[model samples]
Each structure stands twice: as C-alpha cells, then as structure tokens.
Target: MTSLTIIDLSNNRFSGPIPPNIGESIPNFLYSLLSNQITGIIPKSIGYMSHLEILDLSRNSLIGSIPSFISNYSYLYFLTLEKNNLSKTIPKSFG
Candidate 1:
C-alpha cells in the first residue's frame, strides 16, 4: 500500500501484524491477505520484496517457519501460505 502496485486484501477481515514495514513499503507488487483474520510471524521484512511476483498469505492465523528468505526472492512465482498456523519444514526455497 506504500505506493501501491497490486494488492488484494482478500476476504477483508484483517487482523494483526503483517505490517512489518511491508517489504520496506511495497517494493513491487502482487500480494494478498487471503481469507484474513491474520495473526503473527511471516514478517522477516518479507524478504524485502525485490519485485515479488505473487504472494498469498492463505487462510490467516500464521505462526512461524517457512521464512527461508521466502524462497530467496528471485522473482517469486507464486507462494501460498496454505491453511494457516505455519510450522517448520516447507522451506527449500519452495519449489
């Protein structure tokens, strides 16, 4: 939202956190807050956006893990935080 490119506040029942400077203020687009009710974690400065392609924070209530530099950026194709309450082990730069 810092200069906006393409953001979707999906399902629009927003909760807390997620505003961890928001990739240092929207550094390129395609983002979604899917099925809101958002909680904590996933911040890690969102790996500094770096012209991100597509990202979805699926189903809210996020916890920890999956940060792994968020697939080391490199123009993220499409990332979905599926079903919420994140835990360890889905890292490997996510496909």
Candidate 2:
C-alpha cells in the first residue's frame, strides 16, 4: 500500500506493543517482525521512519527500553533486537 517496500511478519503468535502509529501507518516500509510473539514497548513512533531500511525485532517476548527514537533511522541498514526480554540499558543511541 502506497508503494510499500517490504513487511514480513515473521513466525506467528504476535502479541502486544509495536503499534504506536507505526511511522504513520507504514511510511516507507522495510519492517520485519522477526520470530513473533511480540510483547510490550517498542513504540516511540519508530522515529517517524525516515525511509527505514531493515528493522527486525528478533526472537520475541519483547520488553522495555531501546527507544531513543530508534536513533532516527538515518536510513538504517539493519537493526535487530536480538533474543528479546529487553532490560534498561542499551539506548545511548546504540553507541
């Protein structure tokens, strides 16, 4: 839709979070929800997607922290939040 790029909802059993308008409802796609069963927190509007490249929420059961507006994308090449159940740290714009 609207000339979408790619959206792969990986490995079913999707849960909550991951919806905060999703960059105004899929703006310049390339989002893959890897290994589904998504949990809470991961919003922050996805930094308004400045033409995202690849964002994979790896190995689900997501938790909080990791949202520095996703470092504003900067045309992200690939960002995977590995093996979920995230904690506090890991946000200094991912250094």
Give all TM-scores, in the order shown: 0.32, 0.31
* Prediction 2 global C-alpha lDDT: 0.81
lDDT of 2 by residue, 28-73 (tens): 7588899988888788777787888889999998887787767766
Clash count list over all predictions: 0, 0
**Overall local distance difference test of candidate 1:** 0.84
Query: In model 2, what is the error at residue 57, expressed in angstroms?
Result: 2.0
lDDT of 1 by residue, 1-95 (tens): 45777888899898997888778867767889999899989888878888888999999999987788887877778888899888957787467
Regions of model 2 farther than 4 Å from truth: 1-7, 14-29, 38-59, 62-73, 77-84
What TM-score does candidate 1 reach?
0.32
